[model samples]
Target: MKNTYFFLLVIIVQFTNAQDYYFPERNESWQPISPVEASIDSNKLDAVIAFAKANEYSGSRDLRIAILEGFKSEPFHEIQGPTKKRGGPAGMILKNGKLVTQWGDTKRVDMTFSVTKSFLSTVAGLAVDQGLIANVDDKVQSYVWDDTFAGRHNSQITWSQLLQQNSAWQGTLFGGQDWADRPPREGGIDDWKYAKPATPGTVMEYNDVRVNVLAYSLLQVWRQPLPQVLKEHVMDRIGASTTWRWYGYKDAWVDVDGLQMKSVTGGGHSGAGMFINTEDMARFGMLFLKNGKWNDQQLISSEWIDAAITPSQPNVNYGFMWWLNQKGPRHWNGVGEDVFYAAGFGGNFIVVDRKNDLVVVTRWLEPSKIGVFMKNLIDAF
Candidate 1:
C-alpha cells in the first residue's frame, strides 16, 4: 500500500511537470502575477517550452515570492532545500536600468562565489585607477611574494597574464582543485606560488587559481585585504554593509595571528567579499552600466568601466573576471555569445544586457537539472 501511494505521488508530480508553466511559492490562496515584457525570440521560446514540458521528471522548480515585504523577509537566503529549490532567479528591473533590485533584500548579504571575481576585477580597476599599481601589464612576481619558479613548469609570470587567466601555474599534480586545497607557499593559504611564469597572452585555460593570485598580489600592493578595498570603493559606493555574525555558538571570526585568516575575492570565504544581497548586486550591475556612477558622484571612471566589459582573452570572452558575449548571439561561441554574464558555480548568474539595460539574477540548485528552470524563466523575460 505504501509503495502504491508513493507511485501515485510520483505520477502526480509528473502530471504537473508536463504543463508549460512555472510555480512560484505562495500560500494555498496565492496567485501568480503573469510576466510583463516583450516576447523572447519566438522560435527559441517555443523550443525551451517544449524541452521543459518534456523533462517533467528531470527537476522540480522551487519558486517563491513575497511582494513588498521588504528586505527583512526570510526569502533572501541560501536555499538549503533539495537541489531543485531555486535561489535568486529572484530578479528585478529599474527605471534607470537597474536590475535584480526592488524585490528588496538589497543590502542582505550572501555568497556570490565567482561573482566575487567581478568584484575583484573592480578592485583591480581601482588599483589601476588610483596610483596603487601601475598597470595590469606589470609582473605579478613584482607585486606579490613570488617564488613559484625555484621549481619546474612556471618560473616567470606577468600581471597581465594573471588578469587574462593565462598563468600556466599548474595547480596540483592531481587536479586544480586538489592543488588549490594545498597551496605551495608558507603552508598558509592557497594564494601561494603565483611567482611562477606563463606564456603571457598565448594560451587560454579558464582558471580559478588565477583569481586568488590576483587577490594575493593586490594585498601586496594595496597593503590590505581585497575586502577592505571593496568596502571602500565598490560596496560603499553602492551602500552595502558588513557585519561579523555569530557562527554556530562561539566567538565571532576575527584576525588569527594578527592577520585575517583568509579571504576570497569571489569564492568560498563568506567574509572575503561573499556577503552581499541581491539589491546590492543590482546596484553593482547599475554601477557597471552607468559607467561607475552611483547617483551623482563618479566612482570608477567610465573608461575603466568600458575596459572592464571589453573582452580580455583570446580563448574566452572574459574581461578581468567579467564575461562578455562579443559573438553577438545566434552562435555556439560558448554560453550565449550575445548574453554576457557573471557566472558563479552552484548556479548563480547575473546576466547583463547593456543594449537593453537588463540584468537577470538566477540562484538555483545545480546537481539537480535546474538549467531548464533557468532557461524557462529567462525565456519569459
Candidate 2:
C-alpha cells in the first residue's frame, strides 16, 4: 500500500511540472500571468520595465537615417534593401511560456538587424534535420558548386564556420565587400583591401558580406528562396503571424532550378534582414527555450538547438549566430552563463534563460544597458 501511495505521489509531481508550461494556440491571444502568480516581485518587475523604457535606444526612429550614420565609416556602404521606421521601446517577458509582463506596443513590426542571424541559423538547422546537407563540418564548396566558394581560402570554409561568423571569406556579395564591412578602424580602404585574410575558423569577425554569403550558399543548397523555406518550416509551425518579412539586397537575385529567387541576408547590415513584431520574436525565443519543440511537434531538432548554443572554437560568447552569455568579455556579470540570446543592432534582443524557464524579448532599449537590465530582471525572481 505504501509503495502504491509513493508511486501516486511521483505521478502527481510529474504531472504538475508538465502543466507549468502554457503554449498559446495559433491566432489566439497569449495568456498573461501576474507577477505575483509567476512568483516575481511586482515592484521589481515594474522597475525592470521602467528601466527598459528610460534607456531607449538613442538612434533615429527612421532606420534609414540610422543605418547611413551607423555605417558611414564603411567604404561604399549604403542601404541596399529595405528599411522601416522603428517604434519606441517595446518588450515582452515570458515566464514558463506564459506572458508575465509587457511594455509599449508589442505588436508593432520593426527591423531586427542581426537577430535575423538566429533565424537563419534555424533554417540551416532545418536543412540538417531534413538531410539536405550531409554535415556541418563538410566544406561549403561541396554544396555550393560555384565560384563563390571556389577559391582556395573560400573553399576551406565549413557551414559551421560561416554560422559562427569566422569564415573569413574574402569576396564581395550583393555589392558589399567582406573586407570593407566593418574594416579595421586604423586602416584606409587600400590597407583593408590588401591585408592578409585570417584563416577560416581561426577568428570571429562580424561582417554582413560573409553573412550574406552564408545565406547565398544555403540558397544554392536548398535551391529555393530562404524566406520561403523559413516560412514553411519554422514560422508557420510556431504559429507566427504572416506579417514578418525577410529580404536581401535588390540585386541579390539568382536563377535556381530555372526559377528566379532572391537570396535573403543573414542580417540588416546592408539594410535588409528580418522585419518582425515583438510578439513573434517572443514566440521564436519561446521555441528555443523549449528546445525547438512547439506543442507535440518538434519544429526543429533539439540537437540542432544544442549545437547552435554551444560555444564555437573561435568565440566563447558566440555560437551558430546566437550569442552566448558565457563567461567572457561579453558576459553579463550577474546573469546565468547558460543564458543565450538573439541580439541585434539598435537594441533588439530575445533572451532565453532555460534555468528560470523565462524568455524576455525587448526592442529599442539602449544596447549598452542590456547587462544591467538583465541583472535587474533576474533579481526580481
Candidate 3:
C-alpha cells in the first residue's frame, strides 16, 4: 500500500505537479492512437471518449511509451480522452528495468471484474508453485465440500474443470434461491440444491457457483482467505499496495448459507474486483513474461502458468480466468498466434502475448468498442 494515498493527494494536488507523471515525448517510445483531424480533432476525441464513458466505464485513458531506449521506443504523444476514463486507473510499461510507458492514477484502484478471476488464477498458480495442491487434475472435492444430497459429484469436478467453466453443476436446479440459503448435502432434492453434474467436460455453462465453490474449497485447503494469502505471495511481490476485496458479491456465484455468508463478511466478487491500476497489471504480466519469476524469485511456477493458460477442454477458449485468444479477426495489433488475456466484462484487459513478449492492458467501456480498440492499441506496440 506504499504511496497508495498518493492518488488521493493527486485528487487535490497542484495540476502542474500531477502533470509530471502523465505521458511525455521520447524519440523511441510507444505512441497512442488518437483521432487525427484538423486542430487535433478534439471533437472526434470527445465523441469517442463520450461513448466510452457512457457504455464501458467511468475512468480516463492514460497512455505511456515503452522504450528500449536507443534500440526501440513507442512514440505515442497524442493521447487524450482515454484519460481519467474508466475510473482512471494508471497504466505503464517497463522494459529492461527501465520505465517505458507510464500514465494516470497508478496509485488508484478500481473494480476490473472477471479480470479478478485471472488474478485468482495467478494465486492458484502460486499455490501450485508451493505444491499445496497436487495438480490441475486433482478432484476439486478433495479440497471443497458441497454438503448436499448431490454431494456425489463433489469429487467429480477438478480444479481445472471449475476454472475452465466446464463445471456442469447448474445453479438453476437450486432455483435461484439456494444462492441465499444453501441446503444441507444430506437433504433430498430441494430448490436450494446443486444441479446434478451433466458430465464434467461434455458442455460449457458459465456458472459462478462453480467458481465460488472452488474458492470456498480452496480456502479449506489453504486454510486462509484467498486475498490474504495472495497479499503475501502475489501482490507484495509486484510492489502493489492496492487492497482488492471480495465479500458479498458471490451470491451470484455460489450457494451460501447464513453461516458461510457470515464467515466472508461480504467481500465476494466485488473483492474479486482487484482494485490495482493498470500499471500493476503490467507488472503482474511481467511475472508471466519471466515465466512466473521475478528477480530470481520464482513467485509462481512456470508450469502452473502454462497449465492455467492452456485450454483445458478442446472447444472452450478459456483457461482458469484468462481469455484464450480466439481466432476471429485481424486486429489492430495485427493478430498472429492465439494469445491469452485477462479480460473483464467491459473492455478491461491485460493482454499477455507470450509470443511477442508483450502485455497490453485496456480499461475500456464494458460494452464499448473493445475488439477494435484492442486491435488498434496493440498495433501501436
Candidate 4:
C-alpha cells in the first residue's frame, strides 16, 4: 500500500512539473533552462546533437546550380532571387517552452525551401479567420476572377485543395510551366505537358507552379503584398525579427490596387522563397506548439491549427502544407501520430511534438538521418 501511494505521488509530481511552461516576451531573449530542470536527461540530449553533427550533409555544390540541374529537362523560366551564405549544421531545441539545447550559429539566415508552404498556408488561414474567405470548399474562382483559375478543370479547384497541394491546378504563373515544375523523371516533356488532367482533390502533386498559383490567388484575396500581410498579422505578433524576407520570381510582380506587388513562390525550387534563421523558425514552431496562442493573444485560431494538421483525403500523412506523422505514408519511429512538422529541402525542419511539449528546429542536417535524430531525441525523454 505504501509503494502504491509513493508511485502515485511520483506521477502527480511529473504531471505538475510539465505545466506552466515559459513564454518569451517580444523583443526579449528566450530564457534557457537546463535539460535536467525540464526533466530531460542531459547526457541523452547531448547524444542527439552528436548524432546530428555526425550525420551532417557533406555536399559542397552550389545550391543554385544544383536547383537548375534538377530542373534541367523542364522548360522552367530562369529566375534569380536572393540566397545567403549558408553555414554548417545548426539547430535549437525547446522543451516545455524553454530553450534547452542549441548548436552552431542559430542566427545565420538560410534559404528555407518547401517550409515556406507552411507559412503560405498560415496566410490562407488568416484569410479564413478574417472572413475574407467564406469557406475552404468554395471554388477559388469565386474570389479571384482571373484567367489562371478559369476553365472547366481549374475552376473546380478549391482553397482547401490548394492548401493540401492536391489541387492539380493547371496554369502558368510567373513564366513557369505547371506541368514542367517537377515532372516525373520517367516521362519526357511531351508526356508531362500533354498529360491528362486529374480531378482536383483526387491527386497529390508537389509542383511549385501549382503552389505559385495558390500564392497568386492569395495575393488577389489580400490585395496587398504577402510579406506585409505576414508581418502585420503573424510575424510582428510573434515577435520575429525584421531580417527575414519573402521573395518571388523576377517576373512574378503584378499591379495590385495601383501598386506593384510581388507574388511569392511557395519554395526555393527555382530560386526565390523564404530566407529565415533557426531562432525565428523555432519561435514559429513554438507558436504552433501552443496552438497559435503567443503570450496573451491568439494569433491563429485553435480550430484552424487543428484543421491544418488534420490529414487530407488524398494524402494521409500530409496536412495544410504540414507533414503529419500518420500511419500511412510517413511515420516517425517512436513519436506520437499527432506529431507534425514543417520540412524544407536541404534538410531544414521545424518539428513539433505536442504530446511532449517539444519543438525542434534544424538546418542543413542530412535529410535521411532526420528520423534517426528525432527518434534519439524522443528516446531521451
Candidate 5:
C-alpha cells in the first residue's frame, strides 16, 4: 500500500513539473528559470561554458584571412559584404522552452556563417507550406526554367536534392565555381572541374556555390526578397528583434518583379549570410523545437518540419541543410536520434533536442569539442 502511494505521488510530481514549462514571449527581455528549478546540474552547465571560453578558434582574427586559409586552393572572391568584429564565447541553454542559463553577450550580433543554411531551408519550407512549392521531389526545372536549372543533368535535380546538398549541380554563380569552393584535397583543379557527374540524389557534397544557386532559384520561385519572405512568415511572427539581417554577395542582385533584388547566400562562406544575435537564434531554435509552431499559431507546417529533419538518402546525418543526429558515422554522442541542429563554420550551433525539451545555442567554440560538450551536457541531466 505504501509503494502504490509513493508511485502515485511521483507521477503527480512529474506531471506538474512538465506542466510548469512555457513558451517565451516575443520581447527583448526573456524570462529565465534557475538551473535547479529546470532539473539541470548548475555545475555541469558552468563547466561547459568554461570549456568553451578556454578553447576558442585561435586560427585567425582576421575573418577574411581565416576564410582564405580555410579554402587555400580556391580563387578568392573579394569579400563584398559586411562583417563585424566577433564577440567572445557566448551561449544560451533553454530547458522546456525557458532560458535556463546563458554566458557572454548573448545580444552581440555576429556572422553565423553556414548557420544561415538552416534559415534558408526554413524559408524554403515556408514555400512548401504555402503550396508555392508543389512537392519536394518535383524537379526544380519545373519551377525554375532558367539555364541555372537547364542542361540535361541539372534538370534532373529536385528541390529535395538541393536541400540535402546532393543536387551535384555544376555551375558558377557570383563569380565562384562549384568545383573551386571546398574542392576535395585529393584532387587538382582539373580533377575537380572535370569530375564525372554523379546521379543527383546519389551523392552529398557540401558546396556553397550550389547553395547560392538554390538561394537564387528560391528567389525566382518567391518573386520577392527572401528576407522579406522570412520577416513576414517567420521572424516577425516569432517576435525576433529588428537587429538581425540576411545578406548576399554584391554581384548576386537581380531585377525581380520590376525591382532590383539581391538574392541572399545560404551561408557566409564567401562573406554574406545571416548576421543575427544569439537571442534571436534561440527563438528560431525554439520555433523548431515546438515543430514550427509559436505559442498557439502554426508559422511553418508540422509536416514541413518532419520532412526538414528526415535524413537524406545520401547522408544520414544531413537533412534539408540542418544536421541530424541519426544512426550514422557523424552521430552526436549521448544525444537522441531525433535531435537536429543548425551548424556553422566557426562552431556556431543551435542544437534542438525535442525529446528532452531542450535547445542549446553556442557561438565560437572549437568544432571538434562539440561531441564532448553535448555528451557532458546530456550527462548532467
Candidate 6:
C-alpha cells in the first residue's frame, strides 16, 4: 500500500513538471539546463551528437546541385526558386520546454524542404480557427470560386483532403503539373501524366504541385501572402526570430484583389519553402509540443492541434501534413506511436514527442538513421 502511494506521488510530480514548460522570449537566449538537470544521460546525449555528426546527410552542401541531381529522373524538373547551401548537422533538444543541448551551428538559416508542409498545414489550421474556412470538409471550390478548383475531380476536393496530401488534386499550377512532380522512377513520363488520379481522401500522394495548389487556395482565402499571415499570427506570437523567410517559385505569383501575391510552395523540391534556422524550427516544434499554446497565448487553438495530429484515413503514418509514428511504414521501432514530426527532404526533422515531454529538431542528419537516433535519445531520458 505504501509503495503504491509513493508511485502515485511520483507520477503526480512528473505530470506537474511537464506542465511547467519554459517559453523563450523574442531575441532572448533560450535558457539551457545540463542533461543531468533534465534527467538525460550526459554521455548518451554526447553519443547522440557524435552519431548525428558522423552520419551527416550525404548531399551536396550546395543545395542547388542536390535539388537538381536528386530529381533528375522527374520529367522537365528544374530549380524554379531560390536554394541555399546548407550548413552542417545542427540540432536542438528540448526537455520540458527548456533547451537540454544543441550541436553544430544552430543559428545558420537553411532550406527546410517539405517541413514547410507542416507550416502550410498550420496556416490552414489558422484559417479554420479564424472562421475564414467554414469547415475542413467543405469542398474548396465553395471558398475560392475559381477555375483552380473547377472540374469534376478537383471540385470534389476538400480542405481536409488537401491537408492530408490525399486530395489527388489534378492539373497545372505555376507551371508545375501534378503528375510530373514525383512520378514513379520505373514508368515513362506519359504513363504517369495520363494516369487517372485517385479520388480525394482515398490516396495520399506526396506531390509538390498538389501541395502548391493548397498554398494557392489558401492564398485566395486569406487574400494575402501566406508568409505575412504566418508572421502576424503564428511566428510573431511565438516570438520566433525575424530572420526566417518563406519563399515561392519566381513563377508562382498571382493577382489577388488588384495586387500580385506570391504563393509559397509546400516544400523545397523545386527549391522554395521556408528558409529558417534551427532555433526557429525548435520554437515552432515547441508550439506544437505545447498543444499550440505559447505561454499565456493560444496562438493556434488546441482543437486544431488535435485535429492536425489525428491520423488521416488514407495514411496512418500521416496527419494533416505532419508525419506520425503510428504503426505503419514510417513507424519508428521502440518509439511511442504518438510521436509526430515535420520531416523534410535532405534529412531535416522537427520531432514532437508529447509522451516524453520532448521536442527534437535535427538538420542534415542521415535520413535512415533517424529511428535509431530517436530511439537512443528517448532511451537516455
Query: Candidate 2 — number of clashing residue pairs?
Result: 0
Local distance difference test, candidate 1: 0.50
lDDT of 6 by residue, 1-381 (tens): 999999999999988865679898898888887898888899999998898999999989999999998898888898999999989999999987788999999989999999999999999999999999989999999998579988888899999999999999989988888899888877788889899889889988889999999999999999999999999999998889989999999988889999999999999998989999999999999999989989878899999999999999989999999999999999999999999999998899999999888999999998999999999998888
lDDT assessment of candidate 6: 0.92
Candidate 4 residues lying further than 4 Å off, grouped into runs, are 1-19, 77-79
| Residue ranges of candidate 5 with Cα displaced over 4 Å | 1-19
The residue-by-residue lDDT of candidate 1 on 1-381, one tens digit each, is: 999999999999977643322211211111222233333454554454444334432222322121112112212222221121223333344323422223323334445556777777788889888977776666666665555322444546666666666666554211123133223335433243344334557765555545565665666677755676777776765654343111110111224346753334344322223544565565577667556766556889887777667676564477767777666321223234445667664445566655555555544334133345444545545
Q: Which has the better TM-score: candidate 1, or candidate 3?
A: 3
Q: Write the per-residue lDDT of candidate 3 for residues 1-381, one digit (tens) a residue.
A: 648788867776756533322222212233333324112244543443444445544323321121012112112212111112235423443333234444455545655646767776766676677788778788766655545214555447777776777766444221222232223345445433444546776655555445555555566566666777777887676665455454423342343342232112111121334555666666667667667766566788777877777765644467777767655332324554466777664456676665545555656455346555445444444
lDDT of 5 by residue, 1-381 (tens): 999999999999988865665665567477788888878898988887788888787656567776667666675645766666677788999987787888889988989999999999999999998889999999999998578888999999999999999999988887888877777778677887899888899999999989988899899999999999999998998889889999999888898878999999998887889999999999999999988888778999999999999999999999999999897988977878888999997789999998888989999888888888888888888
> How high is each candidate's TM-score?
0.60, 0.98, 0.64, 0.93, 0.93, 0.95
Ranking by TM-score: 2, 6, 5, 4, 3, 1
lDDT of each: 0.50, 0.92, 0.52, 0.86, 0.87, 0.92
**Candidate 2 error regions (>4 Å):** 1-3
Which candidate should be chosen as best, given TM-score against the real structure?
Answer: 2
Between candidates 1 and 3, the lDDT winner: 3
Tell me model 4's lDDT, rounded to 2 decimals: 0.86
What TM-score would you give candidate 3 relative to the actual structure? 0.64
User: Which regions of candidate 3 deviate over 4 angstroms?
Assistant: 1-90, 93-99, 102-104, 145-150, 170-197, 246-272, 314-316, 328-333, 366-368
Superposed on all Cα atoms, the candidates' RMSDs to the truth, in angstroms, are 17.0, 1.0, 15.4, 4.0, 3.5, 3.2
